[model samples]
Target chain A: MKLWKKNIWKNTILIVFGIIILLPFFWMFTTSVSDPLKIFSEKLRFFPEEWRWESYREAVSKVPFFLFMWNSFKIAFLVSLGQIITSFFAGYAFARLKFPMRNLIFYIVLGTLMIPGQVTLIPLYSIMAKFNLINTHWSLIIPGLASPFGIFLMRQYFLVFPTELEDAAKIDGCNVPKFLIHVALPSSKSILATLGVLAFIGSWGNFIGPLVFLTDLDKATVPLGLYRFMGSYSTSWPELMAATAISIIPLIVMYIIAQRYIIEAYSFAGVRK
Target chain B: MGKKKWKKSEVMWGYFLIAPAISIIAIFALVPVGYAIYYSFTDYSLFHPPYFIGLENFKELFADEDFWQVVKNTLFYLIGVPVGLFVALFLASLLNDRTLKLAPLYRSIYFVPVILPMISIGAVWIWIFNVKYGLMNHFLGLLGIKPIPWLTSYEWSKIPVIITGIWQGFGGSTIILLAGMQNIPGEVYEAAKLDGAGGMKMFFRITLPLLSQSIVVVTIMSVIASFQIFDLVMVLTGGGPGRSSASIVQFIYEKAFRSFEMGYASAAAALLFVVIFIVSIVQLKISQRITNY
Candidate 1:
């Protein structure tokens, strides 16, 4: 009976905290559909008295929302795909292969993770300028394609993989690439998904990279588009909120679908480091 | 001869596998950082060729009051680190209760904010803190309190940004700490219980000491993240109400992009790098000391 009482108190507190955390999100959705004029009224209403669906229409039409989303999708898709392929092969080599200077090379890869991006921003921009890659999606996609963190995460995952499977595959006359494709890759679904989701969400939400590299509206990503919209229409709260809501739906959906793997993978990364 | 050829082929394949990633990192990360160090001593605007200035940028930066103010602001933002750590540890303890039902559901709810884009978070909070009709003012009004200007007031500007930082970050930290807590041996807890140690006592004596490693990791990460704060200040406040909340990174961005002072920006970035490098080393030393206990 005493234990039951404690459980009730604990659950009540958790529920209240959850509501407080979620209130801003709730307000965002309500404000998006609320009447524009009524939003600034003296009395704040939790639920909108009058819903205006036009805000969504105006929000998208006012900016090149589709183009921005397309750019974001393309950049994220390509970067995640590239990182997966590169990190997989590199991780396999580091974990399984016997090579000269293998440990030293792996340490070099780990060392890169400590250097923050700001240290390289200026010269990277100049290098991009030299290559005439500025204002192009390649600038964003290429840098993101080779993450030290991804390589490290993949290496860690591969290190623990059972060697028995590889031995069996070798006996069956499997070459290195064939073993990677048929044996290792098939068993790595969870790690791949974890890395894919992380890379996708990261590239999708990246602000500084897009802010620095892409200047044109046509090349803007979702965050950049939202920032531009907020700057131009500071007073248009409803439309701004509508745009903000629309922009986060993909992230929210992705989080919901892969919450377990995302949290586990990230915590593993943190703990292992 | 066949065996020798196979060994050679294997070594070649290993090199082939890692070459692409290594080359990209070398070009993008390593080389640019080298150039950043080189550019710090030279004046280069996009229109003009870079010329050696021989510490002119660094000399000017030392005497610049605005740079000092932004540095102060950056240090001030570190207040969020302790606040975030405390909140994360508390929430993690609560959720770590094995008896707690729907823990996964609650954990996901808390983590939702972390995954959302900072732009969206900034936009939503901007409305929530709107002086005239914000939800925050509405709550204050209910308590017979006057509305406070959240983002516009210089004194209050940093508060909301700090609050949002903690809110967005603590969820991840909480998950991390919880994992660390679980790794603590069950035997320790059993011994504590047998010793008649109360909840708080056990927490301090067992949980905290055992959890010190994760705390160090989280603290260092938080400090690094708070120092690099730009997006929140950019979207929410714009260093507002007379540069009250301007961070060092924001200043660097403005100098680089707005003023086109490439040399000065590189100097500032180099200084930031030095500070971070020192802080990380210090943190490593401290963590090592704690682990020795």
Candidate 2:
């Protein structure tokens, strides 16, 4: 009986702490649906008294939701596709190809990992301005296409892949592209999936790049759209939270769908470093 | 060395495969860095054709008090990175206990903050930290103390931003650390317990030492993230109270975009780059030594 009580107490403590951690998110969702007056009310309630979907409607209607979503989708899709292609080839080159200065080039790319984006921001900005690329989607899309981290991640994943398969493919008279396409890619589906999800999520959530480049309202991405909402309607907590919820919903869904794969691949490879 | 004849087709295909990536990097990353280096040595404004002034920008930067103040603020910001990460690691360790139920639920709850936008959080934080009619003030009111000027006061402004940052980021650190902790061998802990090691003893002796690799990874990621911090500072205080909260990135932003001092901004950015490069190298060296030890 005493042991049972101890277990029960421990379980209760865990549950309470769990609730505490979730309190803000719960409040965000609740406030998004709640009346504006009740949000700031002295009486703190966990649940909304009345569930109103109007706030969500108001949030969507306030901005070009579809256009912004499309902009985000276009940029994110191109970025992910581009990263996958680039990282795969680069990763293969670093892992398999024999060339002079390969290690030197690989290390140079790895060195880019340490340099913070702040260092590159002004230089990139000036270059973009010179091309008259500011306020253009290409400005956002082009820079994101070549990610040093993607190369690093792909390299790490590629290192552990067995070389016997490649050798077999070569013996079968398959060229490097054929070997990569037919054998290597088929085997590395899981890693590719991991990289694809990560790239999409990173591009989708990146705020600073879009903020710097997308000066035109029509070209604004989702995060920037949310920023503009917050600035224009500073008093509308309900609307702002609603907008935040909408913007993050897709990412959260993606996270849930890929959660198992993400954990498996990332923990397997991630902890090794 | 066995000299393998390179197929022209194969080499051409390799180049073709990599062309898109290289061109983008050249246009966006490499060229910008090159121009930034050039501009760092100039007196270029937005209108001017970047006339050569030979180290003038860097020279002026040395005498800029605001620049020094931003450096101090950035150091203050970086201090939270380690403290916050350690706390997160501790939390991850706790949550990783086998006896703990609903681990995924706990994990998701902690990770929620990380998914939310910094701009949105900054908005919420501003309301929370407001001196009058704010939640923080009201909570502090219960203690019978005067309301603190969180964003208005020079001393207190940066700290609240730092605290909010810690809260939002600790969840991610917890998730990554938890992932690391999951890799620890169960028998190692079992062996320690069999040797009459208590909870605290096991944690310090076994859990922490085994978790060094993750700690290093987490430290590097956190430091990089902290150095690039701009949105929260941009939204919350706008580097108020005479630029007390102006971080190096925000300073660069203001100089380049707001003031249109392209050359000066590029110089500042180069300095930021050098600092991050040096710090990251130091981290890598320290991690290497730790792994060796």
Best by DockQ: 1
Model 1, B1-293: lDDT tens digits are 34323377678889999998888888999888889888899998888978899999999999999999899888999999998999889888888888788888888888888788888899998888888899888998999889899999989988888988887888889888988998999899999999999989999999999999899889988999998999998888998878899999998888888899998999999999988888888998988999997
**Which pairs of residues collide in model 1?**
none
lDDT of 1 at A75: 97
C-alpha local distance difference test of each model: 0.88, 0.77
DockQ scores for all predicted structures: 0.72, 0.42
> What CA root-mean-square deviation does each model show from the true structure?
2.3, 2.9
Q: Could you tell me which residue pairs clash in candidate 2?
A: none
Candidate 1, residue B212: the lDDT equals 90
How good is model 1 by TM-score? 0.97
lDDT string, candidate 1, A4-107, tens digits: 89878778877887887799999999998988888878977889987888898899989988889899999999999988888998988888787788889889
- DockQ of candidate 1 (2 decimals): 0.72
Off by over 4 Å in 2: A1-17, A233-235, A263-273, B1-16, B130-149
lDDT (tens digit, per residue) of candidate 2 on A1-273:
865575576666556656655655566687788887777765455578899878888888888766888999899898888888888887776666655555776776666665566667777877778889889888878888877667777777778888787778889999988888999888878777887777787778777788888887778888888777777844477777787778877777877788766555445544655
Q: TM-scores of the first chain across all predictions?
A: 0.97, 0.91
